[model samples]
Target: MQISYLQQWLTTPTYKIHRSQLRFWFSLSLTFSVIYSVLALELAFRGNYLIDSDARQHVFWMQRFLDPALFPNDLITDYHQSVAPSGYAALYWLIAQLGIPPLILNKLLPTLLGVITTSYCFATCLQLLPVPAAGFIASLVLNQTLWMRYDLVSGTPRAFIYPLFLAFLYYLLRRSLLPCLIALALQGLFYPQCVFISSGILVLQLWRWHKGRLCLSGNKQDYLFCVAGLGTAFLVMLPYALQSSEFGAVITAAQAKISPEFLPGGRTPFFHDNFLEFWFYGKRSSLVPRLSRITPLIYTGLFLPFLLWKSSQFPLARQVTPKVQVLIQGIIASLGMFVIAHVLLFQLHHPSRYTMHSLLVLLALAAGITLTVSLQALFNWAKCSPKSYPWKGYLARGTTVFLAIVLIIYPVFTPFPYAKYKQGKEPLLYEFFSQQPKHIMIASLSEEANNIPSFAQRSVLTSEMYTIPYHVEYYNQIRQRTIDLIRAQYSADLTLARNVIETYGADFWLLDRTAFTPEYIRGSNWLMQFSEARAVVTELEQGIIPALSGIMEQCSVLETEYLVVLPTDCILKFAQRKRN
Candidate 1:
């Protein structure tokens, strides 16, 4: 095909779109989604091994289900295992039983999910606007947006939200009751917070705004869909509320507000002193977050309403389906939940959850349509050569081609991913720790502690990244553990160090070369969450000699340039020998 012919075919018309055109557009959208996903999956394979950072907390424990003895009697293991929803855990367990390692599965799942998510996104956009290329552009932009972040690559429970939620949207648009319910059930099963969001959207469907007045929908089918979808949400969510966890009751909103864990600089910090940010613009609390900035293609979505309103200038508005209003309903539902989440704090989980998913999807659809309309207008105008400037046609063609290239590669070429999709660095250290007995636990202040569980298949007393304080029983234990570990590390007294060892069954005390320095405690965001870390930093700055600092050289079991692993038993033995 000639380049001009191909360009004209791809550029969707503002009016008179055909059924065959829709099929071709859908096929092209799927092809692009596959290409983008393949490029991302290839990045995962660039290293000898790679692990998703979020998977460190969520997926590592699944290794135990595959082999019963992997993390026996381990606090971190048992807690992470308990917190995982039954379905998410069962899926990983089933995969693990089939001889795929959890880490391996994590690497592979993202591509499949990306393709699935893009497919549904395209179908959903097609329902909103039958111009097939509009759906094509929207799916392309959505896939690019997803890839620029760790959302897809993480392959954690949160990763399931895009595909499951998009599938629900697509099914709802098609009025496929059974599949819609199944999507709702699967979302509840994996990411339960989304079930509430889905329920809110479903509830909105029953209400309609008619000519300046609010009224219920005339369709009985709307009520029927609402009842079935909402009922499924309640049934799936009921188990979480009814079942008592060994970790005890869920932490109330009041409890979380006072806890330093929610303060600025702390892990999962939601309450910012800056009122604007706390209410509307926090990274985790914001309506859209940094996604718009990361992928500037989303800005095009703002122009969609303008183009749509002036239907004469942009006849693409004629192709729009009233069903497109469902996305607006999703946005309304998302914002409602975001505010409720903020008002209730951690009670509804993170406020960002409400907006990020819907807003991104909505923006992608609108942006796709906007760009499609722009390219179509430009190409159609190019056919009529201006009498004076023959280069006008050539310039239009170049601009369209450039825009397509920029959209396709927008965030992939960025130096950093929008989300922190970390990979473990120290393979030698991981291998060394993996050789230890299954029951042995390590104590550390190193940030590397977060990566240990997944990379080494061993447990740590606590890690900065894994400190999600949603349960009173769990948070209390973790808070105390953090205090004790910090205090024991800096104590000049041998008695306190031995107490930490006995209290938590610390088989090994892992220390970084700079672990006892005051700056280490003061600078770390996670350590500041503990009441003990502040005092420890002050005491160390006062030039108090540390007991572990002295014993680290004496009881060392393993040594690397920056890391020192002191056997707790060896330290106790040294103390006993001195007493003798």
Candidate 2:
């Protein structure tokens, strides 16, 4: 009797809620979303010096909104600012007028985005399965998947993709033309890659498999909606396609194939020796990432089709509306674009981008429906157990209790806020640079260069983080600067160091404590990209000291536990004194 009652209590929320009480489910879904956002915020503001890792590259240049003089003539800043989506940049620019620094805004955006994403996710789930519990389950699973990755917390253009894409799905499912067109336009402005996915979905909706035959939809409305949506997508994306960047053309797949930047262990590695990894799990190449592996409950989505097949066995499965076909259309659309992206390669951006975001939404819906159906089925089985096989009844009751408990408590054990917050460890170094003139440029081969532009609000000649090789002209200049910096750092002749400092107009040099050693050169993957690193390592191994190494004590303006900063003027003076 106690077991039967327990099963009723466990399944009541999903089974008892008819279509009218959906607000109850919506409120519950939103409550959990707020709770998840609260947890992420706690970690986001954990330190005064912390910034999201990707935001270091994407958000740092936005500091110019507050002070136009910052990062003057900086190669790294200009390139990053140029590549930023116009809508994203304009949003930050508008907000900067209200005096909130972009970094602060970046941290706050994730919480707002999470709530918006959750709201859309819940509504989209309800379209497919009206059960309130299913909506809650889907939103809950998506929040877990989102917080597990850096995308949401980064607050870059990619972060907007989730809510905008989910909004597109919800509107598309509702067959609302104007709102859907608006969603399509917003996606193109913020994250253009999704417009292709949205366009693909719009195109795929015109055809249907009816009675085992693939046929075009006879409804004229379908064709009209497709044309309108496609037209919106094209207009929004045309500017990006037709507008030529001064940085030159995007790298071709042929060029990328031979470039070190695309090789294993390189900055943006896409190709891999392992076939399975390259095709199935590589971050840049995979169709679907193993997100379900991390949040195991998502694996339940795989059972959705099976449950629908045996709809007679699960009462709630019958409530699943024909709109569930939208999810199927979404997956098919994603797959279609994924194939086209692979064929076009870099022209479409990463192929994985086409599929991964949409798959997250599709999987969440499927998982929610599947969980609700299974819960209802288990409850029914448990009720019959006492009248029939006693052992079978106990098993059903046990499994029901277990699943409910795991769902409620699983997030407690999973790590929170995988935002990859890069904390500025050397406060004194940042302070020293921050005090310098805005026109000053720092040259460095140290990883610390990646942090300087963000933390100190100063320009760097180049950084590994800023070395995106897409635009050939921009990358050539960046590559040459990197090679020159490497050669100067490890050369025995002071004249070479003097020439590099003058050519780049470098005002300061940042260095790792171990930068002069052969092991440092050999171990640095960024440094190894340049052939100059090998020659430097060879010289260091032969016990030859670099000119900069001999002058560190004389030229250094600031010192940290792991780094040294040298004033360029002091180094130049030393080189002149030696020349005399």
Give all candidate RMSDs, comma-separated: 2.8, 2.2
lDDT for 493 in candidate 1 is 74
Winner by lDDT: 2
> Which digits, one per residue and each the tens of the lDDT, describe model 1 over residues 104-190?
888788878888988898888878876667778898888778877777778888888999999999999899999999999999888
Tens digit per residue, CA lDDT, model 2, 137-179:
8988888888877788789999999999999989988889899
Candidate 1 to truth, TM: 0.92
Where model 1 places Cα greater than 4 Å from the true spot, the runs are: 1-8, 11-24, 377-399, 416-419, 577-580
Of candidate 1, the 10-residue stretch with the lowest lDDT total is 412-421
| TM-score per candidate | 0.92, 0.95
lDDT for position 25 in model 2: 66
Each model's lDDT: 0.79, 0.85
